[model samples]
Target: MLIDIFHDTVCPWCRIGKKHLFDALAQRQEQEVHIRWHPFLLDNTVPAEGYEFRSFMQNRKGIKAEEIQQIFDNAQRAGEAAGVKLDFDKIRLAVNTKLSHQLIALAPANVKNDVVEAIYQAYFEDGLNIGNFDVIVAIGTAYQMDASELKSQLNDRAVSDAVIAESTFARLNGINSVPFFVINDKVKVNGSHSVEVFLETLNRAALLDIPAKI
Candidate 1:
């Protein structure tokens, strides 16, 4: 089964949703699946220096820090339950994820998951700046990827263009917010719902042969 996820780098809820999804997957041993990480920019045209991640959310999203904290609390709980660590205190920048998305899309099928997990953990837990080329190249290298090749590839127009195309495609699919999960290309779930909900929906989709949800 293929679960197509449209997500972003700076989204706390998206991080939590990913944790929930992975936890659901880990509990089951028999189901085989492929993870495809697609790009969805929270802000596509932000300035090069980017903006303070938390302040940007307060100003643009109009969500108070306290409300955001409550949300983060949920994420923290969800992440801990799932064995995922989220560095809420350390996250600071809202970077352009164009190149990160590009790296993910162009990566070989075998390494795409590594790319996705790297970005997610790096940005959300390790507090690395993924928008910068150097950090991305470094992450790509950690996966045993060629750093120079990745740097050259980032400058290529096709990958950035592809990121834009996928973002547009996501909007056209009626997806406004993310961690948007498209299961078997037929079932779609938005936001971080309970594991039971995911288990039920995924099993009913007939995408996995496993008789029960773990």
Candidate 2:
């Protein structure tokens, strides 16, 4: 079965959802599953240099700083429940994710999942500025992506455009949120559902794939 995951690098829920999906996959060891990652920018208008994280969240949600902290606390709890750590306090910037998305797009298929996981860890755990070219280049190189080639492509305007275009296409297709999943083009799971939910969806998709008697 093939699963297409649409997510943003900065989204904590996306990381949680990814863990749930993988946990589900782990339970179904008999099934052969393929994962394809897609980019979904939560806020494309964020400047290349990014914005102060707390202020941006407050302004974007029209909430006070305390309210923003409450929201972060909620997310942190959810992340911990899923066994994924999210240190929102350490995050300083709300960055444009186009470069990070491009790095994932260019990664080899076998290691693309690792690249995505690393990017999420970098931003959410370490609070590294994933919008920075240097950070993304380091991630790509660590994943065995050619260093010079990764740098060249990430710098290319066309590659960046392609990443944005993918996000646009997703929105045009009515995917306005991050952490959405399409399972075998048949089952659709939205938001950060539980491992049981994802495993159930996988089983449903597998059943659908079975041939009918004549």
Candidate 3:
């Protein structure tokens, strides 16, 4: 089975959705599943250097500091339930995800998922600036991607354009949110659904893939 996962590296809910999807897949170990990670930029206008995390979110949401804290508390609780850690306080910037997406696109299939997971960990857990070239390079290298080659590709104009194009494609396809999924090119699951929901969707898609009896 092939699952196309549209998500942003900096999205806490995307991480939770990922956990749910994997948890569902774990229940069906007999089937072979391939994941294709696609980019979805939550805020494309964030400058290359990025914005001050707290202020940016507050301004964008038009919420007071206390209200923002409440939002964080909600996200933290959701993350905990999904078995994903979200250290929102550690986040210093809300960065443009173009470079990070390009890095993921350049990765080999075998370790691509690993690269994705590491990027999420670096951003959401470690609060590292994933939009930074050096930080992305570090994540790439950890997954055995050639450092010099990775840097070169990241600097390539075409690579960056391709990442943007993919995000645009998602938007054109009516995917206006992160953590959206397409299963087996037939089942469409939106949002960060629960493990049970994912499992049911997976089973339904799998059944749909079966050949009809004569």
Candidate 4:
């Protein structure tokens, strides 16, 4: 089974969703499951010039800082339960995730989970500027990716354009919200559902023995 995940690194729910999926996968790694990541930029239309994270949240969602913090806390606790340590307080900027998404898009299918985890940690725990090339360069280096090669790919328009195009395609597929999952391009599990729900879905799919339908 191949899972297509439409998500953004800065999204708390996406991070939580990833953790749950990972936990479920860890329990069932002996099964056949492959994952591919796709970009679902939460605010794709936002100008390249980034805004303050809180201001953007307040303006768009009408969420006060307290509400955001409360939400973050809930997500953080969930993450811990799933064996992922998420640090929200250190996040200083919500730069456009276009570049980060591009990097993920370019990563090979086998190493994609690690690439996605790196992006999540870079944005949440490390508080690194994921939107910046320098930060991405460092992230690639840490992941044992050749920094210059990845950097060169960033400058190339093909990868970024493909990521942006996919982001739009996901929206057109009725994905108004993300952490949208497409298993085998047939099973569509949208948004953050329970780990039990995800585990059941995967197990049922596995029982199908060939292709899965959702």
Candidate 5:
């Protein structure tokens, strides 16, 4: 099975969804599954340097403090239920995830999952600015990717453009939200579905004779 996950590193629900997907896969360990991470920027206009998390949500989304608090509360509950911890209070900045996505794209298949998980941990747990080059380099190196090569590729225009192009392709394909999952390119599961729901989708997709492409 080929699971094409379209998500941004900064999305809390994306982190939860990833956990659910992994859990579902774990249950079906006998089946072969390949995951391909794709880019989907939640706010493409966010500056590379990023903005204070509170100010960015309030100013850009025009969300009131009460509503934002409610959102955080709900996310916390959801994350807990999914065996993931989302420390919104620790997040200082809301950053552009273009560079983070580029790193994921550059990661080798064996370490790609680790790269993605590390990015999620850095942004949502550690509250690190994933948009920062040094922060991303640190995460890449920790995942065993060549730090110097990762840094060089991150600075290259072609790599950045490719990440942008992937985001554009996602938007063109009608993916308007994060945590979107495409199974074998034939079934689409949107949102942060539960583990059972994800498992059901995977089972259904497995029944099909579609060629898996990752």
Candidate 6:
């Protein structure tokens, strides 16, 4: 089955959703699944340098102090439930993830999952700035991708364009949220649903005729 996940690195729900999907796949050990990560920019207009995390939440997202605290608290609980650690306090920046998306696009299929997980861990778990080129290069090197080659590819115009194109396609398809799952292009599951929901969707998709691609 082909599982295309539309997500952004900085999205807390995306992180949680990925963990749930992985858990679901693990339970279905006999199934063969091809997972693909699609890019979705939460804020395409963010500057290359990005914005201060708290300030952006307050100014741009209009989240007040108490509401932000509640959000973080809920996110922490969700992360714990998903077996993913989220260090919200350590995060200092909410960055533009265009370059990170490009890097994922350039990664080989076998290593793409690892790359995506690493990006989520780096940003949400460790509170690192994934928008920085150095951070992204380090991640690629850790995954055994050539540092120089990965860096080159990340800066390539074609690679960047491909990431943008994918995002545009998602927007055109009326998917304006992250952590949206399209199973075999026949079933669409939105948000951070439970593992059971994903497995059920997979089962349902298997019974239907493959839909024509959009």
Could you say which candidate leads in lDDT? 5
lDDT of 1: 0.79
* Alpha-carbon lDDT, every model: 0.79, 0.90, 0.90, 0.79, 0.91, 0.88
Off by over 4 Å in 6: 209-214
Higher TM-score: candidate 1 or 2?
Answer: 2
Clashes of each: 0, 0, 0, 0, 0, 0
* 106 Cα displacement, candidate 3 (Å): 0.8
Candidate 3: which pairs clash? Answer: none
Tens digits of per-residue lDDT for model 3, 40-103:
8888888888999999989999999999999999988999999989999889989988889999
Candidate closer to the true structure by TM-score (higher is better), 4 or 6: 6
TM-score of each: 0.88, 0.96, 0.96, 0.90, 0.97, 0.95
Off by over 4 Å in 3: 210-214
For each candidate, C-alpha RMSD in Å? Answer: 3.7, 2.9, 2.8, 2.4, 1.0, 1.7
lDDT of 2 at 37: 89
lDDT of 4 by residue, 1-214 (tens): 7788889988878988887777777788787777777888887666554667666766687888889878778888877876677787787666789988988877766776888888888888887778888877777777777888988998998888888899899889798887888776666787777789888878776666656433
* Poorly placed runs, candidate 1 (over 4 Å): 63-67, 207-214
Q: What is the lDDT of candidate 4?
A: 0.79
lDDT tens readout by residue for model 5, 1-214: 8999999999999999999999999999998888999999888788978999987788767889888889889999999999998999999999999999999999899999989999999988899999999999998899788878888999999999999999999999899998999999899999999999999999999888689875
Clashing residue pairs, candidate 4? Answer: none
RMSD of 3: 2.8
Model 6, 1-214: lDDT tens digits are 7889999999999999999989988978887788888999988788877888987887876879888878888998999998998888989998999988987887888999999999989998888888899999998888899988988888889988888898999999999888899888769999998889877877788788575353
Instruction: Report the CA-based lDDT of candidate 6 relative to the real structure.
Output: 0.88
* lDDT tens readout by residue for model 2, 164-186: 99999999999988799988776
Better of 5 and 6 by lDDT: 5
Total backbone clashes of model 2? Answer: 0
Candidate 4 regions off by >4 Å? 46-49, 210-214
